[model samples]
Target: MISKEIVVANKTGIHARPASMFVKTATQFKSNITVTKDGKTANGKSLITILSLQLVKGSNITISADGADAAEAVDTLIKMVESKFGEE
Candidate 1:
């Protein structure tokens, strides 16, 4: 398993569009991915679950993946968040 902590950098954080994009990217990996905020965790490949995290700009999140591609999955998602999901 691989995990990384990243701060949400987008203006709107993981809103609908970003959540969709996140789900899309997450689904491409075979790893089991999860997004964690505060004390709650959500399925990374599920839009509803991701949005339920209510992430906002500057919110801290931990992305974790468990599988053969765990490291890649965690890295990719971390980059996405750090890039502000192109919303900036």
Candidate 2:
């Protein structure tokens, strides 16, 4: 398993578009991806699960992955978060 924390730099956080992009990126990996915030963890590959988190700006989220390609998955996710989904 691998995990990394990222602060939401996007003003709107992981709202709508960003969440969609995240879900898309997650599905590209074979690893099991999960994102947690405020004690709530959601499946990264599922759009509904991510949307359910209701992540907002400045929120601290931990993105984790396990199984095959775990490290690569986590790294890609971290890049996405750092990019702020182009929202910031």
Candidate 3:
């Protein structure tokens, strides 16, 4: 397993578009990915679960993955979050 923490930097946080982009990226990996916030965890590949996080600006989140490509999956997600899903 691998994990990385990041802060939500986008103005709108992980709203519909960003959550959709996140899900799209997550589904590409063979690893099982999860996003966590304040002890709550969600399947990274599911749009609904991610939206449920209600991530707002400055929210702290952890992206984690397990399986063959765990490290890659975590890194990719960390980058995506750090990039603000390109919304900024």
Candidate 4:
């Protein structure tokens, strides 16, 4: 398993569109992806699960992945978070 932490930089955090985008990205890999915040864990490939976390701006989240593409999954997720989910 591989894990990396990132801070939400988007103004709206991971709501609606961003959550959809995140879930889409996560589903691209074969690895099992999970995200955690404040002790709450959610499946990265599920919009409902991600949205349930209520990750607001400045919230710290850990992205973890386990499987053949674990490292790539975690790294890509970190990049997505760092990129503010492309919200600018």
**All candidates' TM-scores?**
0.97, 0.96, 0.97, 0.97
Which sections of candidate 4 miss by over 4 Å?
A: none
Q: What digit string (tens of lDDT, one per residue) describes model 2 on residues 1-88?
A: 9999999888888988999999999999999999999999999999999989988888899999998899999999899899888765
Instruction: List the candidate numbers ranked by lDDT, top first.
Output: 4, 3, 1, 2
Report the poorest 10 consecutive residues by lDDT, candidate 4.
Answer: 78-87
**Predicted candidate 4 versus true structure: per-residue lDDT over 1-88, tens digit per residue:** 9999889998988998989988999999999999999999999999999999999999999999999999999998899889887789
Largest lDDT belongs to which candidate? 4
Better of 1 and 2 by TM-score: 1
Q: Judged by lDDT against the true structure, how good is candidate 1? A: 0.93
Residue 63 accuracy (lDDT) in model 4: 98
What are the RMSD figures for all models against the true structure?
0.6, 0.8, 0.6, 0.6
Off by over 4 Å in 2: none
lDDT of 1 by residue, 1-88 (tens): 8999988887887899989989999999999999999999999999999999999988999999999999999999988888888887
